[model samples]
Target: MSTGTERSPAVVGKLSTLDRFLPVWIGVAMVVGLLLGRTIPGVNDALSAVSVDGISLPIAIGLLVMMYPVLAKVRYDRLDSVTGDKRLLAASLALNWVLGPALMFTLAWLLLPDLPEYRTGLIIVGLARCIAMVVIWNDLACGDREAAAVLVAVNSVFQVVMFSVLGWFYLSVLPGWLGLEQTTIEASPWLIAKSVVIFLGVPLVAGFASRYFGERAKGRQWYEEKFVPGISPWALYGLLFTIVVLFALQGDRITSQPLDVVRIALPLLVYFAVMWGGGYALGAAIGLGYERTTTLAFTAAGNNFELAIAVSIATYGATSGQALAGVVGPLIEVPVLVGLVYVSLALRSRFAATPPKSIVHHD
Candidate 1:
């Protein structure tokens, strides 16, 4: 018999109707993008040509719009409270940075040795840890929202520094060790750095500035209640637009061999399941409460596909197999993670009977 912790009403964030039908929206976007790409001649070429030093200018702007609102919600002031639970922090970090990448590398090599571009793409997806969507998932699971927010903030900062170095190493160096001589990406760490700065840096700065100034001027409640909510929807709009643009550019490739998406999705599904299960077990072993356990699990399972897609297109051209793989990441991830939400709810009853911990202390 399994004991369970009671669910707290405060822990759940009521998802909007749009949030509930997110999968349908994304799927429609994919189809519409494909239609535009096929029917409107020169559409893809026009979008692709709007580039600066190999980075697509339009996509960069779209990504910045997509990422900024999420970053703005991060309460940098609350970061100090995270230290009270160092074990959970350490475990979550290990799963995200260390084990996550290694597992991706192993799976990519094992499943896609013959398909190197797809393999590189999968590795890229694994490296870009969750920032935005995990919050929704954490909320739905009744997880520790403050901890999730802190981890998201930390990951955002960490990604800008680490993505380039790791991208170069995993995509350029590690493939050769496995005796895959032909699998080489000429992409430089500088390119990844440049993309991260363009997509992530600008928004990160904007988000911090907005939060810092707005909070001081209008009071915390106004900033939190009004300012944050006002900008949040923009992120989703940007995401949908980015998806359309991605599919518009890659329509030909996708239409030719649609099975390629399925191929890419295989490893991703395994990665999500493994990461969620591992993070949950680790949290349990460390004696974390139900809310914290769900936070760690959802965070571990989620991928920042926005960053992944942008980096893929920037590193390899939009039409490349790698870019298609990146697109597939979100297409599969959204629905899968949605299903995991219910799983988390169901499994809530199986957790040890510890009283749920309140949110961390902060200003």
Candidate 2:
């Protein structure tokens, strides 16, 4: 029997409301971004600042603030219970690194060949997975929060290594069967490393350190009650705003090429459906519980656009189709994942009826 404390009504209610309304809020923000982008042509560049340290300080700040609360909830020790669950980890890795990319590549080839601009966009978007938003979605789905946290940490580490190598190889080395030109794709190892450090690594360290010291100085209960909940929604809102500003910056380009939205949306929709279904099946085959299965499914299906966007800009310039495709990813992903969270909750009853598996521990 589980001894974990049930969530408080207030926390549950707030989460529920956020889950219900977040999509609408994001939609509104996206529209607002388009309008703002149209009205303020130079606003995106204006909001962006370059530092002597060779970084975009404003974007980095937005990413840090957006990522902090999500990472703060992660507890790395939770992976011990299933250290030997190589099947689960293997499934996730294959889906994220291998199958996901293949699907994206296939979809881009099939659906976006005539649209070379959108083709590159789809490639960049599909190559990434959600690092921050998945945490919020997992929590809302009543997932094993600890497990979700561990996966976030794992994915973060893996992306720093894989994104540069794979992105370069994908753009430069892959055969022209997919229409990807070497000149169109550019990868900068240094810039990608900087973006990961600024956007993910720094925030993770800061969030963890803050949580650790706060728990010690106050107490675990106080930290969870007073801090976590307070910060969670705000972090989400921050992310939404940052995305809005990004879209606003691209508003004129998007407005000019309206069909690009449909082109970007189609592959993303296909990617989400295929990955979500595959993730759920793999998790079930591994006998993970409902919460774990749902967590893995959504995490697998979602794309980490923050890193994708950063990489796209660094590699292909801010105005490149690849960068635009990265931006379009969240527009589709956020709403779709929110809907899937509810779907997972509805399926919880079916999963709960199965016999429980032994809780295996690993270090």
Candidate 3:
């Protein structure tokens, strides 16, 4: 008989109430936003009245608030153990950086050929791999927790470097190379770089500084156990506010063209399934066993929807289709990924009955 630890998590018990019903919250936010925008005249215009760097100031503030808490929760000091395992690290890097982005690019273009704004938004989504929530998914699925931590930390750093670069390349150069008439990306590389710096850079530095000082002052235990829980809810509050404002600004278009929301959702659904399945199959083929394989799959599949929304709004304006596409990301992702947690558990039997490789020991 398997030990209790060996058994898959009863997914319901593992997740917090907030995380378990995230889709419901997101749905309510959408409805509330739509109602606010539709029922209240001038709601959209008033929100848009204040602009910072050509984007609505509330959105910029919301993005920073949403991202900083999540980033602060990362254990940046623990990257050393994960680095020793070259095979795991290499596979994660390739799947996250290479396959993940490329697949999303292909899916976005193929599925969204006519809608250039949404297509570019999806590409931005692709470039942003590995979300903070993957930890919850991976843990519920019995994945290697340490590996997931390291990968999240790495991707956090990786995105700061590559988001703008990939945005420029995929939006401009790749389309040129493919001989396809790309949509006019009003934001140049310089503009994208500026957005990335303000949106990602500002929060990143703040997160790092807070953790560094917080831990030093009160020890890692208190910082994580006490300080983190205190601030974690702000991420959700920020996300809700950002969504409310975004949907409010674009609610008229979204309500009129409901088909556009459906279109944006289709590619995201495909991207999540393909990335998760591919990662699992590759993991089994390479003998990472169950835990590491599960970790690989969740990390590979999850996208930084918060960052995607931030960059999209900052670059394309809150009312643009690109922003709408980014808004639709977590809408589709939450329920789909929650379902995948069960799928991962059910399929855990397929891996060989073996203890996962003891590369990095996780608590």
Candidate 2 lDDT over 124-213, as tens digits, reads 766666676676677666676666666766776777678766665665578455555553555465655565567667877887797789
Candidate 2: where is the Cα deviation over 4 Å? 1-20, 49-58, 82-84, 176-184, 353-363
Estimate candidate 1's alpha-carbon lDDT, on a 0 to 1 scale: 0.73
**Local accuracy by lDDT, each model:** 0.73, 0.69, 0.74
Error of 1 at 73 (Å): 3.1
Which tens-of-lDDT digit does each residue in 260-336 have in candidate 3? Answer: 99999999999999999998888888888777788888999998765676678767786788888887876677668
lDDT for model 3: 0.74
Q: Which pairs of residues have clashing backbones in candidate 2?
A: 80-362, 129-303, 129-304, 130-303, 130-304
| lDDT per residue (tens digit) for residues 30-143 in model 1 | 788888788889998999899888666777777777777766776767656665789878988899988888898889878887888898889888888887667656754667
Give me the runs in candidate 1 sitting further than 4 Å from their true place: 1-16, 128-182, 290-292, 304-320, 345-363
Models 1 onward score TM values of 0.76, 0.83, 0.71
> What range of 10 consecutive residues in model 3 has the weakest lDDT sum?
354-363
